[model samples]
Every structure is written in structure tokens, then in C-alpha cells.
Target: MRTLAPVALAAFACVAPCAANPALDALVAAYPDHLAGYESNDLIFRDGTRLPIDDGVKGKSFEQLLDAPDIKDQFAIPYPLGTANLRQPAFNEDPGRIRNQAMFVKMYGDCRKGEVKAQMKAVPWLPSRGGGTVMVTTANGVADQLAKVSRDLEQLPKEMTQYMVPSSGTFNCRVIAGTKRLSVHAYGAAIDLNAKFGDYWQWSKPKGGTLAWKNRIPLEIVEVFERHGFIWGGKWYHYDSFHFEYRPELIALARQGWPK
Candidate 1:
């Protein structure tokens, strides 16, 4: 055997950073039924369809991503999780908010075609707190995960219960306000908690096209939802505090040691 030589590590030598992040990786992994894996430059679907990782447009305006996003544009912003006071988010810190219409419609089905309702299952919301039932997708174990979230949230202090009970609604087959894009609520994978106490960006008037960020949803409630793989809308620059949708990508990166 030849004598082994000591090896010196270079400062620049490090594990190759994934072209796609762990957050994006978890998103793909979480939905194996819909996604296959990433090819060198695209997301491969189980059906052999490939979606490009980037739309090839640089410095897209916020309106561009909201109105029409390429599949990879969904990962443009990092979602901040847990309770941090509202600061004006960076120009486009709308994480989990840039949804690709084709990808969502393919996975969740088009509500207009009567395809979405078929996959929905009713989950009782804060049953112990006397909250009524809400509907969500049964796909990818979302309903089961939400049920777990409900169980844990019910055990929180009474003060926080006000924000969680009397949910505004779920499973609405409608476009997002002022836009043709389907709301995540249309997929039955999103939930809106109490509306009375929640803050919405649209409801407030901005002095000069920039609305002040505000939040009323308790951090405990947000933590419970994030723990169960749901991402809060309050984290968005266009914040909607009561909204929580099934977005494992945002939660996976923000929370440590999330299950794969």
C-alpha cells in the first residue's frame, strides 16, 4: 500500500450549495404525488412534465410575480417565521405568495371544473373551544396535519383562542381580489381564522402606496400552524394575518429540524 499523505482543506472548499434550497427541496419532497424531482434546470413532475426553475426574467416587478409567475418564481422570497414585530418587508418579501397558476391548478385541480371539491375533507376547528368545522384538502396528508394543528392549538391559553376560533371561512372557489389568479383558498388548502381581530393589508390605506405592516394574530397560534407545515400570510408584505395555507417550503426553512 502506498503511504497516505495528510490532506489540507481549502477555505473555499465547502459542500456545494444546492441550486434549489432545502425549503424548495422540502416542498418538492412533501408533494411526491404531484412532483417528481428537479432536473438540472427544471422541476420534473410525476407525469413527466417539466417546469423551468426560472422564468428567465430578471428583476421582475412585484406585480409581475403576483399576476403571472413561472414555476420557479415561487421561491423568490424567503418567508420569515415565528413572532417578530412587523417591519416593512423587503420590496418583494412575499414568500409562499407567488404561486404558479399551472402548478397549483395541476396539483389541486381547477375549481371551475368541479375538480377541487372532490378532494376536500372537513376538519373540525378548535372543537374543544366550540369552533365549528372547516374544509381543507385531503391531498398530501394536509387534512391530517391540520387536525394535529387544531389539537395542539386548542390547548393554548384562552387569550389566544379568540384569534383561532370562529374562522372566517375555507374552500371558497374564487379568484384573489382584483386578480384572475385563484386564491389558495380555492384549493381548500388554506384557512382564515377570526376576521374580526385580524389585520389585512387591503383593509388599510397607505399614505403613498405603501401600507404599514400590522399583525394581531398571536405568535403562539402562528407557531402552531407553522409547526404543522402551514405558512402564515402575515409574513407577506401584503400581510393577511388570519390566513394560513399549506406551504411546507416556507415552514421547513424557518423552523429547525422539520420532518422531511
Candidate 2:
């Protein structure tokens, strides 16, 4: 992980007021157990650690944000929820893609160091579809939420089982492809549905050209997961239709009213 220089810290320390930032408000509200509040430019944790909200940079390219993002960078792209119509995401508009690594490490525990596996618990997948139990983190009630999601998904049409049955995976301790950054899976907060229907950016990438978005996951399934606080990767420009991560903050912001 990259560290911010003292000068950069001082520059972004002037965080905007809470009332003026619904995204920040949602973030604080989403993880009440770990976060105390936000002040000036720092996100105050319950443990008394203050992380700088921004990195004192503006007009950051998508690559830059993906490589080294602070808290505010996570909200650089406003997520659009309650929509099912298939459409292309604007270039590099990956809402939940730019995560604040330090913040997540603090909230979910580091997997590489064995801190994450300790908190993991098993949750049953679509039982009716014969999908067995999958392990996920218990942090932030993720296992509980996933249980709820599974129950709801099981109620879907029998045909939908093909897409949900035999879940691709839930928790895995590994970095993202070709990057040192830890994936959400490393923290046990994300899951991939059936691999047979999965669509990844790299696999679909044409030789040297713009990244195209493709998805086979049904909107009904996506809606069910979103209703339970999971954000679908299908919404990203670099789409991963089969992936969903527990990120209640983005859902809360979209529901309450995201900035236009």
C-alpha cells in the first residue's frame, strides 16, 4: 500500500461538512461499528485512528485512483441503483472499484496475515439448488446478510438455479489479477456466482482497444443482492457480472439520494 506524504495529508485535511456530503454520511452510517465520524478531512475510527479522506489530488485518471485511492476516491463514481436496463458504463466509471485499502484492512482485517480467516463463518448457499455452504467473513454481519440473500434467491424461479447454484466462490485470500491490491474476496466480503455465466473484462477484451461491458447475470438476481446491501460488479465499466461485494454504504447513498 502507498503512504501519503505529510504535505498531501495537510492539503486534504479540510474535509467538507457532513450535511453537504451524503456519500460520506452514508459511509459513516454504513459501518457504525468501526467508524465514529468524519472531521475536517479525516475519517475517525472507533479505535481513534484518523485516515485522510482524500489524497490532495484532483482530476485523477481512473488508473491513478485504482492504483492508490483514499477514502473519498471510493465515491468518485456515483453508483446507480434501482435500475435494471442494460447500458454501458461511462469510461472508467467503476463506483465501488476504488476502495480505500487502509480503511478496509481496518474494518475487515488483513487476510494475508491470517487476521481475516479467523473471523470467517460458513453460510449456506441456495440450499434448494443443492448449492452447499460457503465461507464468508462474519465482520459487519456479512454472513447474516448473505444468509438473507440466499433465502431470497432460493425463492426465485427454479430455472434461476442454473445461475446461482454451485456458487463460484465466496472467500479467497489473494491479490487481484496482475495487481498487488487485495481483492474484496481476500476480506471474505465478496462472492462470485456461477462461473459458467461469468463475464470478465480481460476475457472479453479485444486486442488493444476500448474495454467493452458484457453481462449474463439476470437483473432480478442483481436487485435481490442490492436490496440486501451487496453491490454488483456488473454495474462497473470493467464489468464482472458474477461478482457482488458487501458494500452497504453505496446502497445507502443511492437509496437516500446520490448526488446528480
Candidate 3:
């Protein structure tokens, strides 16, 4: 019997640590063991590492934000919370797309240097469906949460299992294609679902400089991952329906009714 309900995500808002920047507060609370708190202009870690919250650069283009964004830039585009808020995003409105590479590196360690693999452990993936396993980081209870994701996924109708089993892959020590920035998979904290039913903006290649968002992954599967602190790429303007990554901060902020 499944004991965890998606509604339990509401607790992310109810008990987040209060601070000037709610994003930072959610970030600290999400990974309690890795983060301490934020100072006036820096995010302080439990290991005494202080990373600047802002890069002091203004008016950065979309590409600039993608390539070189500060920690706070992660919250520049607010992530819409649930199936209720799903919509066709405006141009370049990619919430959870702008990442702070340095920040992730600080906590998850660099995969190139083989620091991330040391924390990698296999999580059961759709056991009842013969999905086998995928490697994920043990950091911040990610492995545990993914295990929960697997359990919840199994509870869905058996036919839905076809879309989830045989994961695309996880824990890849590589950068996102055509970019120097490391993928969340490089940190062993992202999962790509079965590609047969997935859709990605990159594959669409729409005419002109426009993006046509497409998604075949069911919202039911997405909601299960969200309940366990994963954000779906289907929500992004540059949608990659197969991608789901750990980013509990955005989830918490959305529950707090932010990005207004």
C-alpha cells in the first residue's frame, strides 16, 4: 500500500526556513546536510564554503543566463507548481533551466574528477516491471527518494509501466550536448525516463527561432516524481519530457506562491 501522497509536498511550504530570499531558504532546507544558511551576499555551506548569491552582472541575455548565471539566477524564472499551472511557456521561460554550475559542483562534486561516482548507488527502478536499476547519488537522500519514486510508479496502472521502465539512463559523466555545462545526470541526480514516449524540444527543430513544446509523458508519472522532489523538464519552454532532476527548492517556492 502506498502511504505517501503527492499532497505531502505542501509541507515544503509550511516548514521552510525563513530568510530574505525564499529560494535560498528552500535550498538550505532541501539539503540540510550540505547547506548551512545564506549570508548577505553568499550561500554558506556546512563545510564553510561561501558562494556568492549574485554575480553582480545585469541585463544578461538568455544565452548568458544559461552559460553564466549566479546562484540566485536559478529563481529568475519561477517554476509553475502542478498540473494546474501547466501551460505553453513564453519565449525562453525555462524555470529550473538556469542552473548555478559552481553551486552544484560544490555540493555534488565534479564527475570529471570522479568525485561524484564515489557517492553513486543503484536505486531499484520499477522493480515489478522488470526495469532493473539505475545509479543515483546518495547525497541529500536522492537515492531514497528515487526508490520512493519507483514504488509510487509501480502503483500506477500496469499499462503505464511501458512508459517508465528501461530508463533512458542516469549518472552520465557528461555535459549536456553542445554545452560545457555539466548535466544534472553528471552529478548522478537526474533521471531520463523511457525515450520511446518522450519528447524534446531539440528533436522538434521548429522553423525560425521558435520552440514548439511537445510532451508525451503522462502527468501522472510527472506528479509522482514531483512528490519526491524532482522537477520535470516537460514544464520548460525547451521541453525535454524525458528529463527529471532533483530541484526541491523550486518546488518549495512554487508552493509558497512565489514568482508573482
Candidate 4:
């Protein structure tokens, strides 16, 4: 998820309240190692920091939501799991965007300051496919979950191996393109599968028009990642088919039951 410019934050004068919901519950359950619980309007961290879930603003435009979002904004788009059949998301309906900066910085230290690297551990990808090891954050058992993902992918048919080999790269401490927000990769909690099979919105979008949803990655591969708590970027409206990031909260909620 990327951050919007500061100018975007200045537009909203108040934010709406954040009531307890399935999304919040999934968030609390997903990161038991860090989150304690959530209140009517604030999320209480294990360290007892009271973070405001909503910024008290309402009626934000799609661009505004992308530029400046509170915790609740992250759930504005309900992430659809187990399938890739859907229309293009309403503008800016990026389910995984709108990450709370404070919460993430607290859970996974700031990589720009070298805090994230200290906790990173390497996990071997598809060895048979010539995939070398990639480093992921050890915090919140992310490394362990990714290892499971690798093992599952190894069992796939040989033809699918093409998309499993030669990973793009991981654990780069860089901002997302054209945004001030830190990429999930910076936290060592994300991975990019084969770039050859990848399809990105920027690359697929028609001139002067909307983003066309296109994907070549198989559902079998997507399901494997979701089983281990990773969310595929292909699921996003602004799709990036090769990208997958650790976000078990969304998966757990979808599996157990999503609140209507």
C-alpha cells in the first residue's frame, strides 16, 4: 500500500467514527503478536498505544482515500478471495491500500532506519525451479508462513513451474512508484513471483481510459498463497499479478465469514 501526498490530508476536516466490525476483528486476530484489541474508535496495541482508527472525516473522494486514509479506509473495498471473477473495482477500490502508518511502523520496524532488516530471515523458494532464497520478516511468523507457501508451490505441475522460478526480488526498502508510502516489500512481508507472467495496470491500461483487468496466473497458484495468509495483487482493482503480500487478516475474515 502506498501513501498519498500531504496535500491530500489537508482536504478533510473531520473523519467518521470506526465501530467494531468483522474487518476490525480480522485485523485483531490476524496480528495476535502485536494487536491487543480495538475499541469503539481506537485500536489498542499490545504496547498500549491508543491509535485512532478513523480520522473523523467523511465523504472522501476516491483520490482522497488513496492520498490520506485512516485505518477504517483500508477496508473500504471488501477483498474477494478464492476467485478472480469480478468487474473492475470502483475507482480507487484498492483493498490493501490505506495501511495505518503508525500501526505498521510499530509492528514491523521502519526499514528506512534499518529496523526491519534486523528481524528479516531468509526462506528458500522453489528450489527445483531454480528459485533462490528470499528474505522475509520473521516478525509475526511471516517467514514461517512463506515457507509453507513455497512448499505448496513445489507440489504444482511442472508446467506451472515457469511462474514459480526466478522470483523478481524481495525485501527492498523502497517507496512504491510515485508515492511517499512505503511498499509492503520494505517491511519484508511481500514477494513477487515470476515477472514474465506478471501483468500490471500501468502496462495493460489503454490510452486515456480505465485499467483493464488481465491475468495469466492460475487460480491454483492464487489459492496456494491465500491458504498461507498471503493476498495476491491480482485481486486488486489496480492489479499487479505477480505481487503477493502477507495479509492473513483479510483471508481469515473471508474464510470464517465476512460481515454483511
Candidate 5:
């Protein structure tokens, strides 16, 4: 929610050719409904709003990156795709965590204003196991894509139901545990599985600035979600093993091996 100074805006505008940015290309490709394309250093939305790609802040602290980021910052850390290749990310290597709040609010609508629930669609989560319906947004066909994920998840062995059945939540109008920043759940595009089997960074405090990463969510389940464009929170340095959110742009960037 930080405003750009006029001088900063003029200086950073269009420093590189628009075509040279694969990140921007991936973003437009991921969500065609909200974004039209990129021009110079601005992201052109379908509504004709040209948002600045950079906020003119250099060497941002991790907190700054999460709370105040421009459109381009969303792609600053390339997401690692698939379980076979993902590593225990180095400190603060949270790829899809750095979201461009302005861009997201533009697409998903602000939940605080009652804008997000209006777009909700009830999706049957693992109907085969009698898992009840969950509400999610229809934006960018998220509900449809989740249906596809459900089809794949339900096919897994019945024992897996213990980990998946009774989804923790989907749409919640709230901020992240300690930050002013809104959670993806606020947009109704994120899902949390059975919390009983999930591990969150905040749930267990890190010691001496080092986080001992842990996970109970099976890699098989992670792969299923990744295949359909949802990024796993377990991949983060501050991991959340039971969280999955629809972030196709991050998934698209990972597929291209993320331009260095």
C-alpha cells in the first residue's frame, strides 16, 4: 500500500524492452482474464490500468518484499517445481510468497470489502470419500482447476483421506498471522488441508535465525497439486506443509526453468 514518488516512477519507467521479460510473459499467460500484457515497465491490465512494475526500492529487506512489492517482485524468486527437484530452500527463499498486492487485489477483489465472496464457487472436495464441499473463487477458473486437482487427489489410496478429508479451510477474510499483508485465503484462491497433519513455520518458532524445515505432506500429493498449477507452501523456507494456493504464474515460471 506504499505510494510511489513521482521522481521514482519516471526514473524506473521502461528501462528494458517489454518483450525481453519472460516473467511478465508468464504472468500474462497464467491469468489471461486480468492481465492483458506488459508494456515497458508497466503491467497492462484488461481494465486499461498500467501499473508500474517496480516500486523503485532497491535491496529490500525480506519484510519489505512481502509487505510492499511491485508487480515484477512477484517473479523475483523463481518457484521450484515438482517434488523430485525441490530442495530445502535457503533462508527466505520463498518464491511465490512475494506477491504484488495491488495486482492481486485488482484481479481477485478485496475480501475486506465483501468483494471476494461474491465470486465464490462451491467445489466438492473428494466427494468419493464424502469430503464435503469447499468454497473457492471462480477467478481464472480456479474452481474448475481445483476440480481437476480433486479428481487426481481422490484417485489416491483411501488412507490418504486421513490427511485430506475435512479440508481446514478455503476462503477466510484475514491477514497473515503477524503481518498487515492479506493472506491468499482472503482471495478465496488458496486451500489448507487437514491442519492435524500440517506443519506451519509460525506454529513452531525458529531458533538462532535458523529454521529446521520439516514436512509430513507426502510428495505424491505435492506433485498432484503442482501439476495443476498450485504452489506448495512446504517449498518455502518458512514452510507450511498443508497449504496449497493457485498461483499459475509461479508454476509457469518454474516450467521454463526460470530465466537466470
Candidate 6:
């Protein structure tokens, strides 16, 4: 993994009040196949469509953002990288949780209409750890990035192997559980590790009005994913330890210390 230089860390420590970071910038720049750039609070598309950066709703409940989110709404919660496990996250600690359906569908193509398959490329999982082949999107070098992640992960200690290999799945075009919105998996840019060692909020009973946060995925594995422009669901308040999705926006801001 590339270490964060002390000077870079110092610059990253300062949070921008209402500006996009390099990670988001990278996402926009990387995906010229779909997007144009950001103009004020909107995501400009090459097709001349402008998607708002936020929904203009401040302080929304977690459920609201999930059910009804605008492009801007996706940034409502900041994703925390490199943090220790928490017993419980404050309500709405769902980083990379708010997804704008229109934005994603525009970029990745809606699978319901059978437009997603063309961009997919097969990638091998942790081959050294006995993992098999998995499919991911070739968009914005996603396939190449995952290959790099696989190569790096293979070099880790044997003890860290199980958490990464014997993979769960990749590239399923489907709605998220309990919602009509398509999952990142539909884009073929996300992966779920071994399900046996994963912890999901829906799988557990809620304590009071909140679900307890639990994780078994190692930080070392997470660092690898982040280095390759993926974000871990374990960082969410409604944590899913095995989940890692390609979300360069959050990763860039995280590197800049926006969502600490």
C-alpha cells in the first residue's frame, strides 16, 4: 500500500466546507465515458444532463436517504476509513450509503434493460488463497484495479487469507434488499467476501431502534480495497463487513480528510 506522506496527511486533515475532493474528482475524470464534470452542486453529464449534488434536504433520517435520494444526497453521510469497530454507530453513519439511482444507472447502465453486461470483465480473486474467478465492470479501469487488489492481497500473511478469498460474489444485477434501488453489485464494480465471516445489519436483530455494529473483515484487507478505489461497507453504521464497492468519490475525500 502507498503510505500517506506526513505533508499529505496534514493537508488531508483540513476538511473543505462544501467542495468536492480529489477522489470525487478522480471519479468524474475517470468516467468520461459517462460524466462531464461537476458544476457547483451538480454532476454534469456528457449528454447535457445535470444531476444535483445534494437533494436540498438537510439532516434527513437514514431511512429517508436510502428510500429517496438525489445525486447530492449521496454525500449526506461521510464514510470513515481506517477506524476501529464500533459497538453502535450514531444514526445515519452510512458512508457511501446514499446512492442516486439516476446517476448510477446513467453511468453503469441499467441492468433491468439488459445494458450492464457489455462492460463486464472477468477477474480472478485471491488465487493464492484458493479463490476463483469473479466478474467486475471494466469501466474506469475497475477490472484492472481489482486485478491489482488481488495481486497485492495474495502477498499478505496466510492468516489474512480466509477473510479475502473463497469469495462470496460479484456482478449481480438486483435491487437492494427492502428497496427498489439497484445495488452497486449491479454495476459489477462491487464484491462481497466470504459470507460466513461477514456481518450484515439485516441479518441481525435490532437492539432498541439501532442495529449493533459487528465486523470480522480485517483492516489489512480493507486497506487494499481502498487503495484500489473501493470503500468498505464495514465503515457504515449499518455495517456489512464483507462488502466492498467501487466509490472513488468517498475515497478521495477520505484521503483529504473530509469524512473522518
User: Model-by-model lDDT, in order?
Assistant: 0.78, 0.85, 0.86, 0.80, 0.86, 0.77
Segments in model 5 whose C-alpha atoms lie over 4 Å from true places: 1-17
Count of backbone collisions within predicted model 1: 0
Candidate 3 local lDDT, 23-78, one digit each (tens): 77788788777776666676766666788888899999999999999998888898
Model 4 quality (TM-score): 0.88
The per-candidate count of clashes, in order, stands at 0, 1, 0, 8, 0, 3
Q: Kindly report the root-mean-square deviation of model 1 from the true structure over all alpha carbons.
A: 7.9
Cα lDDT, model 2, residue 137 = 96
TM-scores for all candidates: the values are 0.86, 0.90, 0.91, 0.88, 0.92, 0.84
- In model 6, pairs of residues that clash are 23-252, 53-72, 54-72
| Candidate 6: tens digits of C-alpha lDDT, residues 1-260 | 12244334222311233365554565565565666566566666666677776667877777888888876666667666665543456765888888878888888888888788998888988876788899998876788989999999998899887787778889998989988889999988899998989999889998887778888887888888988888989877788889999887777766678744
lDDT tens readout by residue for model 1, 116-210: 99999989889989888889889778899999999999889988888887999889999999898999999988999999989998899986877
Model 4 agreement with the true structure over 1-260: per-residue lDDT tens digits: 12233344233212134344777778877887777666668776666677888899999887777777888887777677787564566655677866767778889999989999999998999876788899999988999999999999999998998887888877999988888888889899999988999998878746557677878888899999999999888877788889999988888877875756
lDDT score, candidate 3, position 67: 97
- What is the overall TM-score of model 5 with all chains considered together? 0.92
**Tens digit per residue, CA lDDT, model 2, 1-260:** 12344434333322344334677778877877777667768887767699998779988888889989989989888788966565788777788999988999999999889999999999989877899999999998899999999999988899889888889998999999999899999999999999899999878855466787888888889999999999999998888889999999999888877775
Candidates 4 and 6 compared by lDDT, better number: 4
Residue 216 local lDDT, model 5: 91
Candidate 5 backbone collisions, by pair: none
